[model samples]
Target: MHLQFITAACLLASASAHSTFQQLWINGVDAGSSCARKPASNSPVTSISSPDLACNAGAAASAGVCQVKPGDDVTVEMHQQPGDRACRNEAIGGNHYGPVLVYMAAVSDAKSAVGSNADWFKVAHMGLVSNNPDYFGSRVLNDNCGHFTFKVPAGLAPGNYLIRAEVIALHVASGSGGAQFYPACFQVNVGGTGTVKPPTVKIPGVYKASDPGILINIYQDLTTYVLPGPTAYGQASPVPATTAWPTTATWNTALQPSTVPTVVPAAGATGIGKA
Candidate 1:
C-alpha cells in the first residue's frame, strides 16, 4: 500500500510539469526596423572613421535601411517613445570585403511599465543551444537608453545573423514570495559586402512562439543538465531502508541487573522489612 501511494504521487507530479513560455513582439516603428543608418554618401568604399563608426556602419544598414561599404563607419540609434520602444543594431554588409563594426542595444520598458529595478531592462546575446553563455545584465538610465558596440570580426563570411533584444516585465505577487517575470525578444537584419550591396530580406514583425527548434533546445537544457551531487536536503537521494524495533528479549539481554531491592515496611516499625 505504501509503495502504491508513492507511485501515485510521482505520477501526479509528472503530469503537472508542463510550464511554458510565451514571447510577444513589441510593436512600433522599431519593431521591424534595421540597424543601417543613412550614410553621408551612398558610396560603397570609404575610409575607416572611428571604432564606433565601424560597428555602427553595418548595423545601421541592416536595421536602418542604409547602404554600407566595407570600410564605412555607421552610427545606429534606439529611440524610446511613450507608446512603444525601438531596437536598432548592425550586421555585416553583403558586399563588405574588409572587417566591419556591429553596434547593438538591448532595451526594455521603452514604453511599457518596467519594475523598479533597473537591471531587468538590459539585453545580452543568447548563443545557440548546448552553448548557452553567462549573460551580463546592465542598467539603462530612465528616459535615457542603453548601448553596446562590437567590431564585426575581420573577414567574416557573409550570411544572415540576428541582432536581438530581450525585454522583461516584472509582476509583483500579493504575498512576500517573489515577483514573476515575462520576457520578450526582438530582431533585425544586416547586409552588404565589401564592394557589393546585398539584397534585402524582409524582417518579421513578430516572434513565432511555436517554433519547434526553439522548444526542443529549451527542453533539453531543463532536463539534461545535472548538479554535481545530491541536493543538500536529500530531496534527490533514494530513500533508505527502514528498520524494525527490537524484541523484548533482545532488550533485556542488553541491560544489566540493578543492585537495589524492592521492599515494603510498617509505618510504626523502626526497621523496614520486605512484605
Candidate 2:
C-alpha cells in the first residue's frame, strides 16, 4: 500500500512538471521569434494588421496573438541607432533620418502567459513644428520580429525631438490583462545654421529709487529739522520747569520759589491787621 501511494505521488509531480514545461515552451517560441527573426527587406509597407507577422518571418499571426496561457507579464525593449539616416525624402525637401527598433520578452506558465501584438503599434514624431510642408517619413520592420523602425524625412529642422511608439493588446483572455511598451524618445540634431551671438544687457549707474542704499539718505534728510522762528521760540518752553527732569535736590528746590509769606501779621487782633 505504501509503495502504491509513493508511485501516485511521483506521477502527479511528473504531470505538473510536464504542464509547466509546455507553457514555457509556448512563451519561449513566441518571444524567441519576435526577438530573433527579422522581417523581409522587400516586404511591402502596409498598415499594421491583426496577428502581425511582419516581424515573425512573415508568419500568419495577427495582432494580440498570444501563445501562452492567460494572465502573464510581457516585457518589451525598443531601441534606435544614433545615426542610421537611411530614410530620406529628398523630393519633399525633408532630411534623411535614422530608424528606431523595438524588442519583446515574455513570462508564461501553464495557467498564465503573455506575448506581443505588433499590429497595434504606432509611432509619432514630436518636438517639430506642425503644419510644416516639408516632412518625410516611412516605416520599416527591424531584424527582430518584435521591433519596427521609423525613418524621418530629409530637411528636418535641427532640434530636440522624441519618437514615440504606442502599442495596444487586443485579444487578452478573460482574467488576463494586456501590456503596452512605453513610448520611446530619441534626440534629433539637424544641420546647423550660421552661428548667431546672443545680445548683452547693460545697466547704467544711475541711482534707482527702489535701491536700498537710497533709503538711508531719505531717513537722514527727514530727521534734520530747520526752525522757522528765533532762538527763544526755537527752544522748547524750558521743559515746563518740571522736577521730574532734575536729578539733584538743590536744582529741584531752586526751580520752585519759597512757599513762606514775606510779611508777619500782629500777634493780637487789630482793626487793619489780621493774625
Candidate 3:
C-alpha cells in the first residue's frame, strides 16, 4: 500500500507541472482572474500553425478588461490549475526550459477581441539568462512563484489591447514539431494619450516549426538561444551568444500577495482583480 501511494504522489506531481498562465499583476497590484482569459487546461499546443497559438485552445472569453497605462509594469502568473498559486512548485516543471515572451495587440474591443484576428507585436522576451548555471526564463518564473513581469511599451497608443503571455517549453524540442507552446491572453484598457504603433506580426505566421530556437536541444550546453519571434518594441534582439542577460529578477517576491486577488464592488467602482 505504501508503494502504491508513493507512485500516485509522483504521478500527481508530474501532472501538476503542466501549467498555464492564470493571473495578472499590474504595477505590483494583483489584478485578479477576471481580466485573464486563461486556458481551460494546462495542456500545451504543439503545432505552431494552429490558431490556438494565439491565445490558447478553448479559452473562454473574458468580460473584464484590466486597466493599465503606458509604461506600467505588468506581470503574468502561471500555475497548473486555476486558483493554484502555491509558491513551492515550479511553474512549468519536468525540465521544461525555454523563453517567456509577451506580445501586445491593439483591438477595437479588448473584452471581445479574437486573438487570432489581431495583429500582435512583441513587447518583451526572456530566454536563457545564464549558461554557467544553465538558467532559463522558465527558471526565473519558478523562482518568483510563476510570475513573469514586463513593461508596457512607453508610447503605446491608448486603446483596448490584448496582452498575450507565452512560455515555449523546449525540453523535447530536439526534433521538428516537438516544441510545446503555452500561451494565455488578457484584456486591458490602456489610458495613455501616447500614440505609437510598432510593427506587428500574425500569431500563426510569427513562429515557424523550423526556427532554430524552436527546434533545438536544451539538454546540451547551448552557447546561445535565439528568440523565435521578432524584436521587442524599442529593443534590440539580445545576442545570448556573446552578451549575458541579467539574472536579477525585477518582480519582488516578498510583496507577493498570499491570497489570490479578488474584485470587490465599492462606491460604483469595482476594485482590483476586477474590471
Candidate 4:
C-alpha cells in the first residue's frame, strides 16, 4: 500500500533521529510521574556503567514529587521514541552535539528518590552559549529545540531534591567508547529558606572516560571548549537562550508545550511537590 506508508514514515524519521530524556520541569509543571524517570523511549543510557546512572535505573519508578521555590524554572523535555513527542534536531543531520548538564542530590526522605546510592552535585551549565571561536556543538542543535531551561539555584537548600539533566552526544566522540550520554532525573520539593550547600560530585566520579569534555571531536578541530562540571549555579536570571530554534529560533509564542500533565505530589509526601 504505497510502500507501506513510506515505510512507516521512514521508521518514524529514524526514531525521531535518535532521542532521549523524556520530561522534567518546574515552572512549567510535569515531573514525569514523580521523578525516577525511565518511563519509556527517549532512550540513551549506554553504560556509563549503567546504574541508569542513578535515576533511569528505576526504569519507570515513581513515588511522585515536584515542587519548587528558590528561583524556580527547571524545564527539560526531550523525546522521540517512547510515544514520540516530535523530537529531532541534531543540527539537521550533523549527528548529535554535546554539552548541557545539571545535577544535584539530597534526598534522605521520600524513600530516597534517586537510587544507585545517590550523590550528585554540579548545579547548572551551558557550554558554548556563545563561547566564541565559531561556537561549536551546533549551538545547542540549531539553538536548542529539545528544550532545556535552567534556574533553581538561588541559594537553594530546602529539603528533598534530585535534579539531573544531561545531553552529551559528542557526535561519536571520535573514539574511547564514542560518547553518547542522555541522562534524566527530576524530583523536587524545595520551598526554600536559602542556605546553599553546593559541592558533591559522584556520577561515575563526575564523568571521566578520558574526560576532555567527555572525549572531544565535534566534527573537526574544535578551537576551544571546556564545560564539564561546577560553575553554573543560578546566575541571577538567564533562562531563554533559544526557546525553540527552528529556522533560527525566536518562537516563544506563549511557550508551554512539553506535554504538560503530571504534577503529582501527595503520597506520604511533605508538601510543595504540587498537586
Tens-place lDDT per residue, model 4, 46-96, is: 566666765554455556666677777766655545433443434223345
- CA lDDT of 208 in candidate 1? 24
Task: Find the number of clashing residue pairs for candidate 4.
Answer: 3
Tell me the lDDT of candidate 1.
Answer: 0.21
In Å, residue 185's CA in model 2 sits off its true spot by 2.0
Total backbone collisions, model 1: 31
Write model 3 residue lDDT over 115-233, tens digit each, in one string: 99999999999897777656788888887778887889998899999999999988777789878899999988888799899999999889888899899877677777889999899
Worst 10 residues of 3 by lDDT: 266-275
Question: Between candidates 1 and 4, which one is better according to TM-score?
Answer: 4
lDDT: the better of candidates 2 and 4: 4
Q: Candidate order by lDDT, highest to lowest?
A: 3, 4, 1, 2
- lDDT-superior candidate, 3 or 4: 3
Write down the TM-score of every candidate: 0.22, 0.19, 0.87, 0.29
lDDT by residue (tens digit), candidate 1, 167-225? 11111111222111111112222234432222221112111222221122221222122
Residue 134's C-alpha lDDT in candidate 3? Answer: 67
The per-model lDDT (C-alpha) reads 0.21, 0.20, 0.81, 0.58
Q: What are the per-residue Cα lDDT tens digits for candidate 2 across 156-203?
A: 323322222322211110112211111221111223332322121111
Candidate 3 Cα lDDT to native: 0.81
Choose the strongest candidate by TM-score. 3
Residue ranges of candidate 1 with Cα displaced over 4 Å: 1-64, 67-144, 159-161, 169-275
